[model samples]
Target: MEKVRFGIIGVGNMGRAHAHSLLNDIKGAELAAVCDSSPERLDWAEEHLPDNVQRFLSPEELFKSGTIDAVLIATPHYDHPPLAIEALGYGLHVLIEKPAGVYTKAVQEMNDAAAKSDRKFGIMYNQRTNPLYQKLRELIKSGELGEIRRTNWIITNWYRSQSYYDSGGWRATWGGEGGGVLLNQDPHQLDLWQWTTGMMPKRVRAFCHFGKYRNIEVEDDVTAYVEYENGATGLFITTTGEAPGTNRFEITGDNGKIVIEDGKLTFFRLRTPEPQFNAEYTGGFGSPECWKCEIPVAPGDGDQHKGIMRNFTNAILHDEPLLAPGEEGIHGLTLSNAMYLSAWTDNWVDLPIDSELFHEKLMVQVQNSTFQKTPVSQKALDVSGTH
Candidate 1:
């Protein structure tokens, strides 16, 4: 195929952005069709999208319409896996949005389906295109930062107002969103955490505050601790409560340490690797010699969502590798799931968590929910400055 014909099934905030991207910025992608369950969203598409674009009120219609070669599923967190699964079944390449699914059980099933299909399957982990993160991954993977000892990420700038949650019925409720902050806002960071480091935690223990600042029924604040198989430790702290929040990621290894914050990357390079320094040094009150350097990052961010889309298109048309493979999405979702399970069970959760147990616990939250949501609008909000 010269160009990948794309159909977007959910013109919500992110979906609308994807529609615009596929329509204009992405070169090898053509916006073949658009679908949404919301009438207001369909109206917006009618006004904003080209007349040549096929519009559908239901995703199933668009999937089988034979107008699209690929489908981008941008519905709620819960619908991502099922919609992608169905799209794959219809012999269309599938691209899923973040969180993959609220639960790993469903996402695993979707991954299984993708494995059996001969079509291209990818996830919208747009941040993977950022050059800053790509550089970090290179450093770690190249062994420049030898043997990671500790990692900490404080990505808590996702402050959502009451009006934001009040705008959609499926904003923060467990029945609607499955979980908050971790599920909705922090998936990218969680994905980046494992993606950049190339390691998954051996176990995780987390403390989550449900409805701590929001009026919703799901968690809005969380602090999680994880230990890697090599005894490397990590701390992930995030929330949607604080206004003047911070986003800083620091990693320490045997060679030195690196900090990424405020759009700048800094490195403290040790004259010698810490293990060697400790082994060779005879002094009691000394540390390895360190040289601070401001590592230069490439100017401007990557095409982000557009970049991921273009990469997916290239993968389908030219045999290029995917930047964010759909199956790998499970790693980040695993971290998020471990956090929720640790909090819900009041105990530590291990890697490759018991999906059945997590699903059982999640069902209780869904079945026992009594919170009534009041949606303030059915129209899509301007998602320009937000993730």
Candidate 2:
């Protein structure tokens, strides 16, 4: 109980990154076991991992081996929910990777299981650790921005080349990864959008351009319009095709506006609330006066994955609160799903999306997909700088 022994299921790129962090960076956490279905990956683990680290051919085997106290599910999108459920059923603490799962039903089932279990559950929403985002959330929660009126995020800087898409067979395919940029690259932004604003869109209308820039079938470019219950409107735009892309997140409220981009947080505060200014002012075209202020955020990339790992271990050991709860991951997934659904149906999609309809549509794509995937590469790519 002194140090949490962690097993990572999937020795892929993100998986190996977690392994390295657990092995070398994170304190009070030990990389006890590693699992992968690929023989090449297992061989790599054997060669690169410590002599004491246990290796398994499958997650089932890893769960049965009982070599670790907890498991980090870093597998593909479809396998995440079932694997997390299995880990939780085995009475092991679980820390699942982002997006939770491809669709909502399976994730809900996993969430239910975790809720019933006494074990600690966390999600690798590493972006939540970013101090700039954390500061934005604080400002909103603290009412420093007053009532939110509009929000916009254009996070297209997730530029992935053809080789990056070709690197894995299971990537960018409906049967494999489910969705493209929204599911893969922009989950963090989607999560941050709702998390920092503390609001979920009541409805979403989106236009998803499938394979607009990439050769893949899934969507690579997306533009979504969302409306909150509080009548706040928002726009989310992203794509992996654009070079020299933008990564700007802006939120406007009655009293102020916050903009986070280029590793800096900026706020524009109004001298008076918009409503008050509108009610009292006689000027027909003038708006409220404002002062621009650059908000200071703590240095560092928030330690990201390592920070989440440390917190997950601590949460299991000392009953500390988790930075990203496993259940809350569904919110972001729901938004993504809603956007996809909206785009598919050519209409607005409501919140708490029709899980059955979405699943049906997804399976259609899976079954009808004609795009063949290339063989998955065993060579791990260093993704430390990508985030």
Candidate 3:
């Protein structure tokens, strides 16, 4: 086919951004249909979509209408898995928004559905397409950094105000949004954390701050320590209530260190450690001499969401390889689930987690609605710790 027709399932800010880019920017994309259950959202899309495109109130109707080749899901976190499954069942490719879903089991279900369909299945991990992140991945893969020792990220700059959380009712509530910053704000970061390291955590210990950001229920702050199978350690910290925050990540390896902050990715090439007899080296060993340097990277400018959308369409239409496959999405989801579990249990959770057990535990929380209050604690569900 000369062009890939797209059916967008939501018309909110991110959905509209994708539509605008697909219509005007993406080379091989064509706007074919728009679906939104909300009448106002549907009308807004109708007003914005170019001529010759169809508008529908539901995905089923849109899928039957046969106006597009693929479905782009931008719905709420809870609806992504089922919607993607339904779209894939109808022989349509799917590009789901991030977090994949609120739970790891949900992501697995979506993956299973996509596997059965044999069509292109992908998650919107737009951060992977960022030039800097892509470059970092290449560097680690090339062995230029030697053996990785430790990685630390302070991404508190993801500050969210009360008004932002209040913008949607299904945002911070347990019955609605499912989780907190881990669900909504940090999926991309978590995805990138694993992507760059070429590693998945074998165990995790987390401390989460629930109902800490104003009147919201769910965590707005999280501090997690991860141990990879390769023996590398990582520390991840983030919060939505802190202003004047940091988005700095430092990766230390046997040979050097890479630091990314303020959109400028910098490296510190190490020299040698000071002498153990020296005052700087008080027998406890000393630190290495590191020089700030710049790493070479590619140059590109465009929307990552649009880029991934174009990539998904190209992969479906021209046999192109997918950059962010649907299966890899489960890694981030598992990590997110493990963090919550660890925070609740105050114990180190292991990887390759038991999806069914996690699902069962979660179902109990869903049924216990006694904590009818917003932001029900995992502890409240008889889980573990509190922040």
Candidate 4:
């Protein structure tokens, strides 16, 4: 195919943004079709999209219409895996939105489908395209920071009002969207957490407050503590309640420390490794000599969501490697699932969590819920800065 004909399956806030990009930004992508359940969204597409771009209320019909060589599944979290699986089965390249799915078991099934198919599979882990995170991953992989001792991220900059949640009935319910904050706002940071550090925690113990800040049924506040295989620990704290919040990621190692905050990357380079300094120094009270330096990262975020789509399209056309493979999305979803499980059971959860048990518990929450969310508006909001 000279160009990858793309069909977007949802024209919600995120889906609409992606459609605009596929139409104007991505070089090797052609916006051939769009599918959405909302008639209003289809109306918007009819007015904005070109005459050649087909509109569909059913994704299967669009998939079989010979209009698209690939599919971008931009539906809700619960629909991601099943849609991707069906599209992959139709012999089309698949790119799904983040969090992979509401749970790992379903996402694993999607990955299985992708593995069986010969088509390219990618995810919208747009944050991976950021140069700051790329630089952090490089530093970690190069061992410039020695052994990781601790990882901490405070990403509470995601503040949402009640009206935001009221925009969609599926916004914060267990039956729809699954969970809040972690499932919605934190997927990017969660994915970036392991992607940059190159480590998955051995165990996760989390405290999550369901509807703590917002008048919703799902978690809006969370504080999770995790331990790695190498005895390194991590702290991930996030909430949608705080304004003037912080977005700081700090990693400390035996040799040095790295901090990404305020759009700047700073490294505190120790002259000697901390362990070596402690072992060889005669002075008991002496600390390792440290020099702070501003690490230079590439100027801008480098296209971000558009960059991921461009890479996805390039991978389909030129056999290029995907920047964010769909399978790797499970890593971050695992973290989110484990946190949810930990909070539900009030115990530490392990890596490669018991997907069945988690799913069962989540079903109980959905089936036996006393929570009811009444959406105030069905109108889509400008999601440029919100998500």
Q: How many clashes in each structure?
A: 0, 0, 2, 0
| Model 4: per-residue Cα lDDT at residue 294 | 99
lDDT of 1: 0.88
lDDT winner: 4
Regarding lDDT, does 2 or 4 come out ahead? Answer: 4
* C-alpha lDDT of all candidate models, in order: 0.88, 0.88, 0.78, 0.89
lDDT per residue as tens, model 3, 285-308: 557677788876666633487778
Q: What is the TM-score (0 to 1) of candidate 4?
A: 0.95
Q: Residue by residue across 152-242, what tens digits does model 2's lDDT show?
A: 9999899999888887666788877788999989889999999999999999999999999989989999999999999999999999999
Please say which candidate is ahead in lDDT: 2 or 3: 2
Off by over 4 Å in 3: 271-289, 299-302, 364-387
List pairs with backbone clashes in candidate 4: none
Instruction: Rank all candidate structures by their lDDT, best first, as comma-separated numbers.
Output: 4, 2, 1, 3
Inter-residue clash pairs, candidate 2: none
Provide the RMSD of all predictions against the true structure, rounded to 1 decimal: 3.1, 3.1, 6.0, 3.2
For model 4 the local lDDT of residue 264 reads: 91
Estimated TM-score for each candidate: 0.95, 0.95, 0.89, 0.95
- The Cα error of candidate 4 at residue 314, in Å, is 0.7
